[model samples]
Target: MSVLGSLTPLPAADHPELLAEPVVKALSRLPDASGVLVAEIDPDLADTAAFCEAYSSPPEFSANCVVVSGKRSGEVRYAACLVLATTRADVNGVVKRRLDVRKASFAPMDEAVELTGMEYGGITPLGLPEGWPLLIAPEVAAAEAVVVGSGIRGSKLAVPGAVLTALPGAEVVEDLARPA
Candidate 1:
């Protein structure tokens, strides 16, 4: 295995090898996933900045999945936003308007973790709630590959941009995020 940033790269793995059941199921259900290469990392370094610095990875190669929620009318709506680590999801602007809600904010950590059945720092769009749209920034979907959570803090998945766009419910949006 080789090293990527601060993580120990592993040979290409079946989703079941590195991801939780939910993630595995999601990937398997995709019409034709190109497969993901996984790397093991310290759970403590799962956050994007730390993980990138420790692994010698550039921020552009890492994508963050954030869950957002708000109410439109009387019902709550949820969405997952995927943006590069070098940028921030425009929660109050683009996202709120996209979801057609009065306001939007990051979902409470507990609710995110509980609903996704993934660790707090490892929520990926791959296994998000079925009804939630997977809102991906256009830049993120244009990258060659991006490092994302494997549904657990202990590992990461490197997936092709094409494969990411292929995920169920994924929607590529322009300027969904702003450079930080």
Candidate 2:
């Protein structure tokens, strides 16, 4: 119940204006969507650090979502990763091997935004493309509740952490990330 700071959150489905189009659509299709909550914030404070500092939310209140990409043969593959803000995803080691690519790196900002139909700083795993992988660190999937981006800078979403593991193509990987 207490995921983010003292700021109260509303049912995400009840406040479509706070979410991006894709985020809204994704939530609408989930039967467990009732647990998702949304909180409005100053757009300028949308980034993790600023939002936590300003809202009194703990620094680790949420898992951070990042997009990574790698190419294999003539095809390129992309995946979304969720790790604690205090940790960094193992893009070069575990992830590269998982994707079956020779190398892997963070996806370019513009490409990420365009592909996800979401704002750059607010890219989230909830509404990724159908075939993309969703690699989640065990730490993130085991949390009581996870607060993450809403696909827009003006708001954030919170849901039971286990919920993420059930999303399509979500894979829980140990050491998906290492402490920063």
Considering every candidate listed, which one attains the maximal TM-score?
2
**Model 1, which residues run further than 4 Å from truth?**
1-3, 6-8, 11-17
Error of 2 at 120 (Å): 0.8
Candidate 1, residues 98-151, lDDT tens digits: the string is 999999999999999998989888898787878789999998899788889989
What would the TM-scores of all predictions be? 0.92, 0.97
In model 1, state the lDDT of residue 72: 83
Residue 40 miss distance in model 2 (angstroms): 0.5
**Candidate 2 lDDT tens digits, 40-77:** 98889988888888888876767899999999987989
Runs with alpha carbons beyond 4 Å of true place in candidate 2: none
